[model samples]
Target: MKKDKHIDPYKHVAFIYPDIMDFVDYKWWAKYIYSITVNHLKKSPSVLELGAGNCKMAAYLSEDYKDYIASDISLSMLSGSVCKINKVCCDMTALPFNKKFDLIFSAFDSINYLTSKAKLQTLFQQVYSNLTDEGIFAFDAALINNSYKLQKVAETSGNFNGIKYYRKSKFYPVSRIHKNIFRIYFSDKVITEIHTQKIFEFETYFEVAEKCNLYVADCLKAFTYRKAKATSDRVQFIMKRKT
Candidate 1:
């Protein structure tokens, strides 16, 4: 079916995203990250968060750190932020920042959107350049197990006020890609947004970080301190500069 209007990813979703993700406990998530910062760095540090969609988590996280900046590729998403901290619209692979941050991170499997090993490497390079000597880069990626779980859902739909939205989700094992197609119905037209994420092997991230002069400080299971395994559904990687 041809869509009446094709909006950028997160353009229309931004309006209802909070409602869609109302189940998440941003407070708990913020606490988890904050604890990691305390354990790893031993002090509150300057922070830069990449792919901070709507900065909802930032609303709960920013106060604990010395300095914080939330960034995303979509301006529309940043415009919907729940917090008042610094927000910047920029690509994760090519960060534009003059000052280095003590802790640069991304959450919610945002790194999976890179879709290519080359892009992942570029992101690591950017992180390497933007990190303070003792800074760390922390992020998560959805594993194949996550893709399998997503495929089980297949489709979901919801309505906000009078606006209707439907999502079709699929995962291709052979291609290692997870795609979500969203159709939002408005009074005048329908808007469609396609989002694709690559499920890379658990080892690939370590390889990329090594090549970028970054070393893995830890790789943990989501929401826990246990080391992540190949069979894990989602994994968080904490990396530090080699120097």
Candidate 2:
């Protein structure tokens, strides 16, 4: 769910995305994320998905909510989702909700795209203000371990609907940022996109939460019930607004 200039890269190839999802096992991913997230929610809570790309999770879990909104910065991406979810195209950092939510979530390391501590803090504050009393804010981040791994991976390439593309990743340790570069060869031209993400420290998240009036409720390893540590590859941070 990374982005460049706040534009979702998937929108550029939305036409060929069905094949892409099949290759990536999108159903399995959505189910896995849904299972991990739903276990932490209140029954029939009002829900909002921050980076509701393709509404994959919403497709599986929206029926369990009192009301559900699937949001993304890309209208085209939201348009492509096949689900009975209320789709909203909006920026996650600058949420435009007047009504409070019982739960707001973003999976697949969407929060990492904030790309800076200040941005993350701002996001937390926005989320805190939008949540109702006892509301939960759950999101995940890929730390430096994943950055290092991505940086070490060999170049990867793929073909979508006859169009060719290549992916390369780089990690800037000093900035704790990872950029995934994609070069796409279209029929008439070539385009490049660089998606950026930050690797925030474990304690930094808590510090931001405390400052934003959001309290850390749990820190769990992604895809598992184990406690998360600084060394964990990815950590799911669950926070609650101070009532």
Best by lDDT: 1
Residue by residue across 173-236, what tens digits does model 1's lDDT show?
A: 9999999898989889899888899999999999999999999999999899999999999998
Query: What CA root-mean-square deviation does each model show from the true structure?
Result: 4.1, 3.9
After superposition, the stretches of candidate 1 with alpha carbons farther than 4 Å from their true spots are: 1-8
Question: Which stretches in model 2 have alpha-carbon errors above 4 Å?
Answer: 1-10, 13-41
Top TM-score: which candidate number? 1
Clashes of 2: 0
TM-score of each: 0.94, 0.88
Residue-level lDDT of model 2, residues 114-138, one tens digit each, is 8788898899989988998878888
lDDT of 2: 0.80
CA shift of 177, model 1, Å: 0.8
What lDDT does each candidate get? 0.88, 0.80
